[model samples]
Target: MEKVRVLVVDDSALVRKLLSAMLDSDPGIEVVGVAADPLIARDKIKQLNPDVLTLDVEMPRMDGLTFLENLMRLRPMPVVMVSSLTERGAEVTLRALEIGAVDFFTKPSSDLANCFAESAQEICAKVKMAARTRPRPYTQVQKIDVPPRLSADAVLPRSQSPGTRGSTRIIAVGASTGGTEAIRVLLEAMPPDAPPIVITQHIPAAFSGPFATRMNNCSAMRVCEARDGQPIQPGHAYIAPGGEHLLVMWDGAKHVCRLHDGPQVNRHKPSVDVLFRSTAASIGAAAIGVLLTGMGDDGARGLLEMRENGAPTLVQDEASSVVWGMPGAAWKLGAADEKLPLEDIAARLLVLAQQPIAGARRAAS
Candidate 1:
């Protein structure tokens, strides 16, 4: 097996030593070089051409974000950010994902021994994943710092069209990485009478409750972490809570969100696959499955199963995703029924609800 080459970039000499020692300890990984900052990294890149770069968010001479933006534009490759587990750290880390970093790890400040140990393992695994990711070329463009101004209908109204005909509709959404913000944006656009939405996002226990609370306040949809035996009612959004698998159970009369503590499928406890499989088996032809921004193939096959079972499924297009791994995998596997950019997804979703179940053809434009 070819060893994955990695370059470590950090301002702290101790961190450089620690990360170097940890990553180098992995038999599958080879530490190609080390650098203190982006300037030094640029030189090392020229010399070593490492397969992966583990970067510290805060470094002397320049912050990681600026360096990342420049690097992606000039020489795009796999870059995993090491961030502090703080509010500011999370915020910047989110920005790095959006800017095209392949993965991230919170620099363990509390238990240096355990954290660094875990980070080393995670870094090697991520480097392996990164080696397989075909990075897009860096492009220079002006930031649309301003979002398109949305209408009351676009931003605030319920998703149900006024005088809309009756159609059995269920929404299934999945995401990872910067999904918290993306979920907020997409759900907040719906009206009070929107169709029931189900979401499976990879999140931590510390964040999901707050994330659910945050979602409930933003959308008219009654968003909550799913519990066993909880009925899935119209005008509600059920989120698969962190650290548990969420599946759907249906009777001819109604459907319910079923939470389980089963072993993780595809290495994710609350997997997109488990949720999607249940959706396919129960909801069948009556659901709209969505594959959103994420970082793996966990949901791809399940979404295909959903499509085969008659649920029309959509994937987030590469142009809009933070990391297109999940959606791209689905598209490649012939699982996705359609692909749409992030901003247009909600608008198109309403149309999917109204379309006929038979002759399931996708209009990708």
Candidate 2:
């Protein structure tokens, strides 16, 4: 296969050299050009037409954000923002992601750091996959008109919803792409004692650490990345590491996490399917499964199997999704017992978790 062509842009010659060397070291990627600033980058965009562009946030001539806005407006392609690790930098990168940049990373501190950041292994992996994606024109998203905040009580689940069946006391969800903000809506409105929650959002190595920190600061529930052997406790939410799959195992009396690096399922290492399937297997008939906004069908079949194994499932309604790909695919397979708008999901899920499970099981039996 032809190598993925990359254009590296940074104001610093050292950063340019480091990025170019790092990307070119990978067998799957070839640095076609390097630009010292966005001014140079703009010229090369028309000439080289590289598959991906690695951009620095702070640069001479024009700032990266301004360049990115212009790039998306006139000629949109897949661009990865490279920013320093700062509170403000993170906030900017998150906005860039929402704006349509595919992904991001903090600029490594030095040449050695750059080498470690995109090791020969990861560079090859990311570039190859990125090259396959279609570069859509990045028209800025117009703010959609929304109705008044519907009271949380309006959307009730079907009789088969989780709380209606005793075993549904806990809810586990996984998502990617537009999930950061999506999860914030669902989690913030939820009460303090929401079901012991676990989630896996496909994200970058550096971003997940800060992402968890951000989520914890914003939501009422305690939120953090999962550690191996950490017991699955209620009122807390655990996110799996970005590049590893998180599996759940019952350790005698209590449930514990077993973070592993098994084969990638659904083209993702920290796969939603892996988490949901294991939850279905271990906590069968006792858990509620949720597959939310994402870019692909990563959780579709596993969610279906979860439903088949007697778990109730909820999927995000298409109207509220950023992409609607994952949930739409799951709904097409008839996996979701309930579909909800993003805002109401937390409220309805809480009701399901509180339903009397014993009575529902008695009826099922």
Candidate 3:
């Protein structure tokens, strides 16, 4: 198999060298060349014709976002962003994703060598994943082999099910890879009075707040990062904080958000499994589970559990997904009751939320 070719673009010489060496360490990846800035990168792109481009969020001559917009419009291709672990970096990275970058990786603040050593696997994986994205002539899709991981049971036990339907219906969502933009699109389409939404989108801790803020600006419904013990209500959407699991818990009278600090489940801190399983056990038929575009099978089992418990489930169709790993896994497991494109999911969710729950399970006595 031909290795995925990559071009590294960063204004920092150290970063470019580190990124190139890290990407090349993977046998499946080949770093074709590196450029100091967007102008040089522009010329190299025409010369190298690399399958993927790892772009620095902040550049010297032209900013990453401006270059990304120009690239997407002029010569669409798969691009991954490299961002610093800061508030401004998070904000800029989110904008890059909205501008059509495939995914992003946050650089550590200090201890560069050690941090890069630990993150090399993830960095290479994102580049490989980007290679298979749309606008790049589709080569064979790369398979990501995830090692054994903790399940939702690690955070919240499976035995604890929310046996009764709450007073209000809830919408539970999970996504990764291209999820930031996907979640934005879905939220923007939701009406102000739509059911309460709980989301887990596989992001680093620094990015979640900015992501929520960006979503709030575009979405009609109020959106904010989920707070521990926060009341669940309609006309609002709660985003799971990065590095924490967001679960819906029964508080005897009503459902509320519970943030759990625990081991990474399904190789993700805010694993979709945790959120979906929490919804399945707590909300039962009164909830709708939507698995949007993401890589890996994190949410498949939990979505299946939701279906078994009578909740309606939807997976984003492959054509509309940046990476169909999560949704495809759910489709294969027969977890989703319906598969819809990104464009149709919001309307369908609204419709499903209105359907009355009949014979829904009650809280265990």
Best by TM-score: 3
lDDT of 3 at 331: 100
Maximum-lDDT candidate: 3
Better of 2 and 3 by TM-score: 3
lDDT of 1 by residue, 1-365 (tens): 88889999999888888788777777777888999998999999989999999899988898999999999999998887887766567667666765778767777576666667644544566777776665555502212223332221221122221111124578888887546656877888877778889899887554466668778988988899887888887888998887887777664457787787766567676888877877776666678899887777778877887788778899989887766889999999999979998888888888887777542232111
What is the lDDT, from 0 to 100, of the residue 196 in candidate 2?
Answer: 83
Query: Taking the tens digit of each residue's C-alpha lDDT, what string does model 3 give over 202-231?
Result: 999999999999999999999999999999
Residue 321 in model 2: lDDT: 75
TM-score of every model versus the real structure: 0.67, 0.66, 0.95
lDDT by residue (1-365, candidate 2, tens digit) is: 77788998888887777667667666667889999889999999899999988888888889888899889889887777777766567777776765667656565565555344434443444455545544445502222333333211122111233322234366778887667778777778766677888888887566667777877887889989888999887788888887777776666566777787665666566888888777766666677889898777888877886788777899998787766778989999999999999988888888878765534465345
lDDT for every model? 0.75, 0.73, 0.90
TM-score-best of 1 and 2: 1
Off by over 4 Å in 1: 1-15, 25-79, 83-102, 107-121, 125-167, 177-185, 213-222, 251-253, 356-365
What's the lDDT of the predicted structure labeled candidate 1?
Answer: 0.75
lDDT of 3: 0.90
Superposed by TM-score, candidate 3 places the C-alpha of residue 182 at a distance from the truth, in angstroms, of 0.9
